[model samples]
Target: MAAFTATCCGRALKMVVFLARLVFQLLAVYAVVLLLVYVCQRSLQYFPDKNHPGDPKESAAPSMREVELRTEDGLTLNAWFAAPVKRDGKIVVMYHGNAGHIGHRAVKAQHFIDKGMGVLLVEYRGFGGNIGSPSEQGLYKDGRAALSFLEKQEYANAQLVIYGESIGSGVATQMAYEIQPRYLILEAPFSSAAAVAKKRYFFLPVDWLMKDRFDNIDKIGGIKTNLLIVHGDEDSVIPIELAQMLYEQANHPKEFITINGGHHNDLYDHHAGHVVTEWLEKQIAAEEPAVKPEE
Candidate 1:
C-alpha cells in the first residue's frame, strides 16, 4: 500500500511537469505571432490598390480635367478636378479612405458636382495610379499640395470645404486645424488609428507597434470650422462609436448624423452623400446675409 501511494505521487509530479511544458510552448508560439503582426501591420492597414469595377473614372464626364499635384516632397501625383457647375459655389476637397483610389469615387464626386459644387478628388500618393509609397506624413503632404493648388487658382479658405472619409478623416482634420476651411466633414472616422487597431487586435500591443498614428481626436478640438460627422451605426470597419468619440472631442458648430443600419461602404446607397451636401448647402446659405427688403 505504501509503495502504491509513492508510485501515484511520482506520476502526478510528471503530469504537472508536462502541463507546464505545454503552457510554455504555447506562449512561445503566441510570441512569434505577435512579432509577425507587428512587422506586417502596415501591409494590413493601407489598401492602396484594391480590385474594383472597371475604371472608377470611366463613368465620369470628359469635362473632368486630370491635373498634376506637386507635393512639397517633390513627388508628382495625378488628380481629377471638376469645376463647380455654378461659378463661386463651394468647392469640396475630398480626401478619401484607405482602400481604392479617387477613381473609385467618381459617382460620389458627381453627387457634389450635381449640387453645383466643385469637387477636387484629391488622390494620395501611391493611389489612383499615382507614384510614391503612402505614409502618414506623405498623405499630409498630399493634402497640403491639394490646398496649395486651389490657393493658386485663387480659392480662399472660406470657399473650400475639407471632406474626409475613413482614414482620410485624419488628413482632413489636420488640414482643417492648419487652415480652418469654411466647413469640415468626416465620414466613418476613427478617433485614432491606434484606438481602432486596439479594438481589432486586442491581444496585440498595437499602440506601440503601429507606425502611422493618425491621431484625429487630439487635433479635432483645435479646429473651429463648422464640423459635420456622418457615420453608420452598423459600420463594421471603423465602428460608429469611434466617430461618436471623435465628435465628443470636437468643438461647437458641429453636427453628427448616425445612419441606421448603414455599413462601412454603403452609406452612399442610403443617400448619405445627398444628405451631407444638402446640410452643408443650408449651412452656407444660413451664414449669408439675408436680402434687404428695400435694397
Candidate 2:
C-alpha cells in the first residue's frame, strides 16, 4: 500500500509540472504577441500609399486647384480645393479614410462642386506623399491646419462644413468639438477605434493594446454643431451599430441617414450625395432669412 501511494503521488507531481510548463509557454507567446502588436499597431491602422501614381489633375474639375497646407507642426500636407462653380460661400473640409490619397476623392469633391459647394480635400500627415507620420494627435493638427487655411481664405465658421469619412470621422468629430462648424458630417464612423478593434479581435485584449484610440463617441457629445451621420446597413468594416452608438451620443439638431445595402466604401454610391446635398441646401436656406416681397 505504501509503494502504491508513492507511485500515485509521483504521477500527480509530473502532471502538475507538465501543466505548469504548458501554461508558461502560452503566457510567453501571449506576451510576445502583445509586444508585437504594440510595436506595429500603427502599421495596421494607417495604410498610406505614398506614390499615388494617378494624376488628380486629369479628373479634377476646372476650378479645382492643387494646394499645400502647412500644419502647425511644420509638416507640409497636400490638398485639392474644388471651388464652387458659382461661389455659394459654402465649403466642405473633407477628411478622408486611412487608405488612398487625395486624388481618390476627386469624384466626391466634384459631387460637392456640382452642388455649388467648395470642397477642400485635405490630406493627412504621411498620406499623399506628405511629411510626418499619422497619429491621432497628428491628424487633429492636420484637420486644424486645413480649417485654418480655409479661414484665411475668408470663409466664416458658419459657411464651412466639416466632412469625416471612415477613420477620418474621429478627426472631424474632434474638429467639430473645437470649432463648432455650421455642419458636421460623419460617414461610417466608428464609436471608437478601440471598440471596433475589440469587435474584430475579441480574443485579444485590444482595449489595452491599442495605442491610437480615436475615441469619437467620447468627443461627439461635445460637438454642438448641426451633425449629420451617414452609415450603410450592410457595412462590414465598421459595423452600423457603432455608428448608431455615436448617433445616440450626438447632440440635438442631428440627422442620421441609413443607406440600404451600402457597404463601407459605397455609401456615396447609394445616392448619399442626394441625401447630403438636400440636407445641406435645407440647412443653408434655413440660415438665410426669406426675402421680403417688393412693396
Candidate 3:
C-alpha cells in the first residue's frame, strides 16, 4: 500500500509539470501571433484605401487639376493639385488618413485652396486609383514622389506645408524629418504605432511583438518646422492623451488645438472647413519662410 501510494504521487507530479510546459508553449505561440498581426497591420497601411465604387462625390467643383506621379520603386501614385481660384503661392502637400483615397479629401482640399493654399492631395501606392502594394517604405516613397512632383513645378512663391492625418502622420513625420517643410500638421497622430498597438492589446506583449516602429516621438524632434497637433478632447479612436504626448515629445514652436465636442471623426462637424482653414492660415502667417541656398 505504501509503494502504490508513492507511485500515484509521482504520476500526478509528472502530469502537472507536463501541463505547465504545454501552457508555456501556448503562450510562446500566442506572443508570436500577436507580433505577426502587428506586422501585417503595418504592412497593410501602405495600401489602405482601396478604390470603392459609389463613394460620395466631393462638394467642390472640378477646379482641381489631376496629376500622375511615379515613385522610384515603380509604383504609380495619383495626386490632385487643387489650385485656388486665385492661384495662391502657398501649397499644402496633404496626406489623407489610413482608409481613404484622394477623392475623399475633396472637402479638405477645397478648404485649403479657399484659404489661398494650393493643396496637393496624394494617393499612396495601392490606395485609390494608384498601382502597386503599400508597405511602410512604399508610403515614404510616395511622399518623396509627391514632394518631387511639386518641386519640379517651381512653385517658388508658395510656402510648402505638410498635413498628415492618422496613419499618414507616420509618413508625414518621416518626410518632415528628411526635408524641411514650412509647417508639419498632425491630426490624431500617435506617438508611435507600437504604443497604439500596446494600448489596444493590453494583455498581449505587443511591445516585444511589434515590428514596425513608426516612432513619431523619435522623429518629431528632428523637424525644425512649426508643428501643429489637433485632436479632440473626447477622441475615442485615439485617446486625447496620446496627442498630448506627441506634442510633449515635439520641440519648441509647437501648438495644440483642442477642439470642443471634437470626436475623431467629427472634428470639423460643425465648423465644416471654416475652422481648419482659418487655423491653417494662422499657422502660415506665424511661420518664418524657409531659408534657401544661394542661387
Among all windows of 10 consecutive residues in model 3, the one with the lowest summed lDDT is 52-61
Tell me the tens digit of each residue's lDDT in model 3 across 69-150.
Answer: 7788776666777654444467888877777687777777777776666788888877886677766787889999988887
* 1-295: candidate 1 lDDT, tens digit per residue: 9999999999999999999999999999989998887778778888897322234347664446788899999998888788777667799999999888877778788888887888898999888778788889999999999999998888778889999999999999999999988799999999999999999889888877898989999999899889999999999889999999999999999999988889999999888988898899899999898998995
Alpha-carbon runs more than 4 Å astray in model 1: 1-6, 50-57, 85-87
TM-score of 2: 0.95
lDDT of 1: 0.88
Task: Provide the lDDT at 229 for model 2.
Answer: 92
| Weakest 10 consecutive residues of candidate 2 by summed lDDT | 52-61
RMSD of each: 2.3, 1.5, 5.1
Model 1, poorest ten-residue lDDT window? 50-59
Candidate 1: pairs in clash: none
lDDT of 2 by residue, 19-127 (tens): 9999999999999988998999899889987864245568655567778788898888778887655544789889998798888778777778887788998898888
lDDT of 1 at 190: 97
- Give the Cα lDDT of each candidate: 0.88, 0.87, 0.76
